[model samples]
Every structure is written in structure tokens, then in C-alpha cells.
Target: MMRRLSGLLLSLCLFPVPAFAQSKPCTVSDHPEYTNKIKEFTTESFFSTELVDHLPLSSCVPPPDAFLHHIIGAPDTLDYTKDINAYFRLLASKSPRVKVWSIGTSEEGREMLVAAVSDEANFAKLDRYKEITARLADPRGLSEAEAQKLIAEGKPMYWADGSIHSPETGAPEMLMELAYRLAVEDTPFIQKIRNDSIILITPIVEVDGHDRMVDIYLQHKKHPDKPPYPLIWWGHYVSHDNNRDNLGVTLALSRNMLKTYLEFHPTVMHDLHESVPYLYIMTGTGPYNAWLDPIVISEWQEMAYHEIEEMTKRGVIGVWTHGFYDGWAPNYLLSIANNHNSIGRFYETFGNGGADTRVRTLRPSETSREWYRPNPPLPKVKWSARDNINMQQSAILFGMNNVASNGQKFLSNFYLKSKRAVAKARTEGPVAWVFPADDSRPAEQASLLNLFVLQGVEVHRTERELRLRATESGRDPDAHKEKSAEMSAEKSAGKSPDDAKSKEEKKPAETVIRAGSYVVRMDQPYSRMADMVLDKQYYNVSDPRPYDDTGWTLGALRNVKRRAHAQSRQNRCSRRHRRPGQNLPHPAQYRQHARDFAFPPRFRSHGSRGRFLRSRRPEI
Candidate 1:
């Protein structure tokens, strides 16, 4: 009997039952209508609740369903933003691994919150990790050994925000469930992510809009026959146009998000949106933004392809990329990360705003299989909010798993990209961009400078006047020709070439940059952002058509007088003289300047307490 038992044990060890097989089946479905609709798209294993609840969980922390009183993605049910915030606070209070804090208040007075999920040990060293990322983000004085040491001790912070558009109601719901899984699940996958990376989630980006959307959705559910009531405005002053305010930083939501980004320096920023086939991870088609680091462009594909591969491996279909959107624009909501040397990506899922199941018939073009989209969506599939939630959650999990497993790679690349940005300023031209203090439009100039400061760009005011030679300054085109003509005339007059050269050296084109000018040097880590915003952008005309605006030259748009100072060979001004002057005034000082400007009637009515300049808000 002992020998037989030993043999059976050995056989069991060789081929153990799967985790799901050993756990109890998920028999509870709060909304079978929504749950049943996705059955044709994927199996139970794809649903996040099914997979997460099967794992060992902390009894102290209740799952989202227990707290929300219904499973997320249930039909005709939408939790208000207040309830969501309350649930996040509850998670933070219950779990040592989770912490929630308000970033700022929305325009409509709703609190915008962010939740940080990680292992308890990581939480203990949270400040240390934050410092490490900050150093890596601007590696100027950092040494090779120091960087390697920090990389060994650092954890990549992955940021995922949802529902910026508000009408795409599935993201915030899915995010709430995602936070619960990360906080409570004790499975290997969850533990690995908790141990290796810090997950930061903003459940609802547009808080006011989320509640409005929920109200509209519920009202529409009441009268199925009547056409849905139109939400004339999603934000206080804008609708879907809120996503276009990243570069402009006009909206309160944009400023709050930028503040969070500057503080955390996350390695990845993932924004979730809805309205696509089944799912589309963003690897924008062509005519990519010229100002973004090449590595960032590659990183987009790296993350997108990794998500596609992982999802495909799990038997999920319609996980595609490299279509629909072009990456030529830098004013997108996610462009903040892309400009700051971080991987910024987004997801577009399929949902009809509510939990009701709807059958979607695909055209032949969408149904046909392609290289980017291996297994196309079915010709007709019963889609619901639950289906949207499952696919989004699964894709997000795979993405987090990738980042967690390759934490070192992500950290190292982040450091490398910042290092490259600093080096480019030295080797390449355009050492700095100078925004003059004597511009006719002082308000606009100050507002533009304030925008850079808000975006975390290093801004300094010159203490004294600067006399710089226009060696490579693109201004004064006739100056160079006139000098050449003078030299030619001297040579024609039988003067030696050396004499002409000496005469030319004495009278080179000189440009004076007055005192109090704002200087944005390219030697810093976020110099790419400064360059992209201040420098001209020439989109490649030969590439595919752009999906959005081709140019967002802030200086040109704002009518701010700026000059690019190239590295000069003959300028007498020492490096110390050309160095950045005193740091620009505090953000509040700029806000004071912003208030004095004359804004449009619509924006002026919103009052002076807006984030930045109310009058000069970009219309884009």
C-alpha cells in the first residue's frame, strides 16, 4: 500500500491539475444578460472576475462586487463617481498594498483620485522608489554605477487612466475591478506584478463627465424607444475636445494629469478608450511624430505587439494594431508621456455605452483576416458592456505582466532615452531656445512660459543681456549673404583671402537677447518636450494622411517671439554667460499673469480660477 501511494504521488507531481481546475467554478452572474452576450466571443476564463476571484484573496478586502452591490459591467447599473472614490478609499484602508489619494479637484468640484497598488514592501520604500525614478528621468549628474544600482533597486510605475471621454463608460468600470484584483489576488501573476512594478490607476479621468454619462445612460435605458438625450457638453467648457488639450494644458483635467506625471515619472502611461472593432491596441499607422524619440516610437510597437501576442496566445480574437490612428500629432491626451520619454499607449474597445447586449454585423473589410489582425472579429457577435470589460481587463493584465517581468529593461531604456536627450543638446545644434522678454504680447509670452513650467520643462530667466552671434541662428537670412558679398568684394579688390577673413571675423552678425528672457536649455531630460513645442514641425508629406492636426507649434500658435540659439564657434560669450539664468517664477506667479489676459467671452465667464490662461486657450 505504501509503494502504491508513493507511485500515485509521483504521477500527480509530474502532471498537476491547473489552478482553475482546482478552484471552484464561477456560478454567480449578477447580470446574465451581459455575461451571456460575451460567451460567443470568449470563454469564462477571459472574464476578469472569473479569473481573479478564483485566486486566494484577503478576507479583509472585499471584491468590487461585494462593495458595489453588483458585479461591474452589469446591465442598467452604473456606479457614481462618489461610490467609485469611496470604494477606492475602502481598498486603501483595508489593504496595506494599496493607497489612494486625490490629485486635485475637477472643474465641477469633483475630486480626482489616483490609486497606487504594489506589495507592502514596495509601499514601505515608496518615497525611495519615487526618488529613483526622478533621478533616472534626468540622469545628468548620475554615473553609470549609480544608474545600475538604482535600476536594481527601482520598480517601474505603470499608469493606466480611463474614461477621459466619459461616453466610453466601460473603462472606469473595468479599472475598478482591476484595482481590486491587484490589491487582493494572491496568485503568482498578481504577486509578480505587485513585487516587480507599481501600478497607478486613475479610474475616472473626467469625473464630472463620468457622472453625467452615467445619468444619461440610465435615463436612456428607461426610454428605449425615445432617442438618447444628447450631452451637449462633457466638460465645463468642452466636450470630446478635452483630449486635445494636452499640449495646450487649458483644462483643469489636463493640468492635474500633468502634475501627477511630473510627480511620479511613470514608465508607461496607458489611456483606455472605447469604440473600435473588438479591440485595437494603438500602434499608429504612419507619419509618426517627428519630435518624439525614435526609441519611444519603437516602444509603442513593442508594447502593442506584446499585448497582441499575449492575448492571441490566450485564444482571444480581434486583438489587432497598426491601423486606424496616425501618430503624427503630439497634442493627444497620451502625448504627455510620449513627450516626456515614457511609453504612452491607449486601447480602443467595443462597447455601446451601457450593459445591454447588442449584435454587431461587421463589413467584409473588418471581418477579413490581415497580418496586423490575425483572427478578425466574427461577422456578427453579441456584444455587451461585460464583453468590453473582459477584453480590456485581459489585455491590461497581459500588458502589466509584460512590464512586471521586464522591469529592468523598461527602467534601463527610460534612463537611456533621457540620457540621449541630454546628449543630443550637446552634440547636435539648437542648444537652447530663448523666449524673449520684450515680446509685444507679454501676456501670451508669459502664458506660454507658464505652460512649459507646468509641463515640467526647465525654464530660466536671463539675469543680464546676452550678445550672441547669429552663427547658425536661422534669423537674418540677408546677414550671411551681405557678409559673403563683402568678402567677395574685398577679394576682387586684390586683398588677400586672409585679410577678407579677418575683416569678416570682426563684423559677424550679432543678435542681442535682452535680460529677463526665458531660456529653455536642451541639456535637461525633458528637452525633447521643449524642442517639440518650440521648434518647427515639418510633417512628411509622402507618408499616409494624418489622423489629426499636422502641426502644433506652440510658439507660432501663441505668437510668442522665440529664437533657437545654435552652438557657436566664434561667440565671445562664455558658457557661463550663456548658462540658464535664475529659475522662472513659481507657477502661481505665472497664473497671476494668465489672469490679466483678455479671453473669449465663453472662457471668461468660467472665471479666473482656471488652471492656466483662460483667455489664450488654444482652440485646437
Candidate 2:
């Protein structure tokens, strides 16, 4: 059935078909002046006439109108997920600049697709670019000169996704247009973006929610007088909480995104959202996560401010930054990129659930001018799906242009950040973290270690018991004990206690790690991410309230015993005998081990029911 439908869709794309009838198809004649105003504003302000005039629209490739039967963002209109996928397929089928593939399936079993739009030359050498980014992501063996050579040869990869929340209808619609522009338009601006960077577009992140929301939206439109139908949940399991699964990566969508990040190593990852006054590019209100490199924070501002400045210059109002969210939490979906030494930012545009034009009145707080928001939105104004689409599409174009123009700088910065991470392990402390295997909870321990491996953090297993002296002053318990004894003797001999205690405090301690432990050395490129996950988070009390959970210490949550050792001396027992996956016993093995343990007679299970059916009588 799907194949038949796909064939029919291809036929429609290959040969123009008559417009499909609808209960109410939005047309230019309905509001010709408003339509033309938006069209002119987007073209002249976003892509100047010089660039637009140079764009070569191809007859072989179908525009969004060919599939939707009306201009994109048309009022009172929505496209099905299947139709959107069909259009993307057609684009890839017709254009050398576009390549589409399924990343994975959604919770509801709908295919989630990602399109890579770049120069035809780039598509031919895509594997080479992937290898370049991977090498840069981990700059262990490369010298400064070699790193610079790779930087010059490599192109920056940019990732942009839309419709994560589903109700933010504008982003998904705008992405289709953006994809078409990137694939078909051959202007200098577009060509430069294609030549300099690989653009990745995931039109809809939450596939299930997109289709469900569209259904509810159409129902609401059909009965204007009745109370709107409620969508109990957006995703099958959660609503807005879908974005909160990055660290856990329990959801299919989060896993798929993380896989892509690890595979591509994109320099910048942008997620499109809606709900702010006009458009809010994320620079993030602090206190920022201490684990993040200083460079990552600065890069966030660099991208955000560039978008704000360009949009403001284009006469777009209400584009602002730095007040909505805090950067302390690393649980967001895009936070995956941020933690991995890549820039991850997002946009929040104003949206009305559907394509209909509606009047909205902003509160005084939202309208007042501020340092961040130079030209605030009006107190009352007419807004529509089309307006939302225009703002988001323009901001995205500006962001793409920024990265393309400064590809070398972005790539160089990525290499530098990764190199610094490795250098930190040598200069700073906490040389390695040890997760000791526990007999009682082997499964839990393995699960925690697996999480780290999944995040691309290197892990190794201890073949034997490891003992090393703690070199840091405060870390040595044995040295402290010896110092205490010496200090007591000195005090008894009439010496000052303070002087003796001071001398003892400078001594180093000793630590012993058991056999079968998992060691995660901090010398790797993603050491910061490993530290962020395992170490305790301390949120400042004086700072503003956090946007989400204040802390996410994985070890405590998983009930695993993990130790961060600052010892500088190398130990033979910490050798890596086998891969982490092979060393860690499977969950079933743990269960079998539990079953093999002999229980006390009174507590033993005697039958298939597996209960302590009989117990010895207590002796009086």
C-alpha cells in the first residue's frame, strides 16, 4: 500500500496534476495585498533582489507548491507527514545537491528523515568530510601543523531541525521551503553556503506529534464555535518532556539524534522552536554549566548575536537574546552537541497554532524595550502562520550564511576545543575515574558504564586490583593518618600543634581500586562530558531560578560506586585487557549469577511459585 501511494506521489511530482479540492484552500486572492506584502518582505529583506534574481529554479525539481497545491504557509492549510516525506524524496531524486535518508523510526513507527543538502561535489566526497570531522573531534595524534591542514581542507557541517514540539506548526512548513531553496537555488549566497558547509535538515523531529497535532488543528478549524479538541499527549510517552531525554537517551528520537551527532560531528546544531515574543535566538541566561568549555559559551553568543544583528538590519523586529533560559542544565536534546564541543543553539519564534491570521495582544513585559530586545514587538498586532514562517526562515538563512562565511574559524575552533580537552587531563587533576564492579548490583554497574560508552566516552576494564598513591595534597587518607601521628608526637614533645599539623597536611595519600573495575581516563577528547555526567553539580544559590532540574549526577541516580582519583602515577592493573562491551557481563548473566547464589534455608524458594513458602519457627 505504501509503495503504491509512493508511486502515485512520484507520478504527481513528475507530471503536474490538477489542484486537489479542499473544504477551504487558502488562495492569494483571499488576501492578495497581505500575501504580496509577506512575499516582498521575505524576498527583499531576507534574500535581497540581486540574490533572488540569480536563483535558477529548475523545472525538473518540484517546488513545495507542487505537492501542497498552494503556497507554503497558506492560511488554514496543513500537509500530512507522508506528503512531506514524498516531497523530500522527490527533491533527492531530482537534485544532485540533496540526499535524504531515514535516521530511524519514531515512537509511533513513522520514519524520521534527515536531508543533507550541499554542493554536488560535496555529496561525492561526503565520506571524506565525515572522516575529517571525526579526526578533528578527537585531535590526539595530529600535530598543530597537521590540524591546521585538515581545518583548511574540511568544510563545517551545520545541522538544523524543526517541529520538535509539533504545535509550533511554522517550523516544519518553513523547513520544506528552506530545503527547496538550498537544493534548487543557485545564487551566489546559496552556492557559497553549499560550497563551504554541509547543511543537514530534519524537517520534523517528533513525527508522531506532528501528525497528531495536524489532526487536532484541522478538527478545531472545522468547528470554529466549539471548544477545541484536546491532544492528551504529543509523543506517545510524553509531551514537552520529549526534549528532556538527551542525557538518558531513553527515547528513540533522542537515540537517533545522538547517533547522527556521533556520525557527522556537525560544528553547529540548530533546533527551531516557537513561543517567544517574535524570535528568541538562544544565547542563554547564566549561570552556565561549569563543565562546558568557555569557548562553547562564547560560540553560542557569536551565532545568536549574528542572527539578531542580521535580522534587525533586515528591518525585522522583536529578534532578541539572553533572558529566557539558563545554560546550567545539559539535559536538552541539543545539549548533546554542546557537551561534545560543538555549538548547539535554537530559535523561538511567535506562532499561532494554525495558518489562520489572528489578532494577539502582548503583555507590557513582552512589549517593553530592553538591552537585549532593541525593537520589541508591538503591544497588539495581526499575526499568522505565514508571518511565523517568514521570521524563522529568515533567521535560519542568516545563521547558515554566518557559518558558511566563517567556515575556517569554526573548524579551527572545534579543533582547538578538542585539543584543550586532552591537554586538561595532563595539566589538571582527576586523571581518571574508576567505577568498581559490585557483586550485589552487577547489572546496575554495567548499565551505568554502558551509558558512558553510548555517549562516546572511552572506557576500559581493570584486569587486576589497582593501587596507587594519591599525589594531590587533600586526596591521601594514609598520608593524613601518618601526619596526624607525627603531629601528636611533636605536640607531646612541646612543639606547636599548628606547625606539626601544617607539615602533615602536605603529604600524599593512597587509594586501592578493586579488580574488574571500569576506568574512564580523562585524557580523551570528551572527558568534559564524562566529568559532567559523573561529577556532582553545584548550582549557585544566588543565581536566578534554573529553567529545569538543577542537578543530574548519574552515579548517585544509578546507585553506582564511582571514584575520581587525581593520582599521577600509572598503575599496571589499570590496563585495558578487552573492550568495555566485552568485559561487562550481560544483564542475563547477572540474573543467572543471582540465581546461582544459595539463599538461607528459611528464605529459600521451594517451588515454581518462587516464594519463601516455608520458614523455620523461631526458638523461644
Worst 10 residues of 2 by lDDT: 611-620
Q: Distance from true position, residue 581, model 1, in Å?
A: 16
lDDT of 1 by residue, 105-204 (tens): 8898998888999998998899899888888887877899999999999999999999899888888888888898788766788888999999999998
TM-score of each: 0.82, 0.83
- Per TM-score, the best of the predicted structures is 2
RMSD of every prediction: 12.0, 11.0
Question: lDDT of all predictions, in order shown?
Answer: 0.75, 0.75
Least accurate 10 contiguous residues by lDDT in model 1: 611-620
Q: Pick by lDDT: which candidate is best?
A: 1
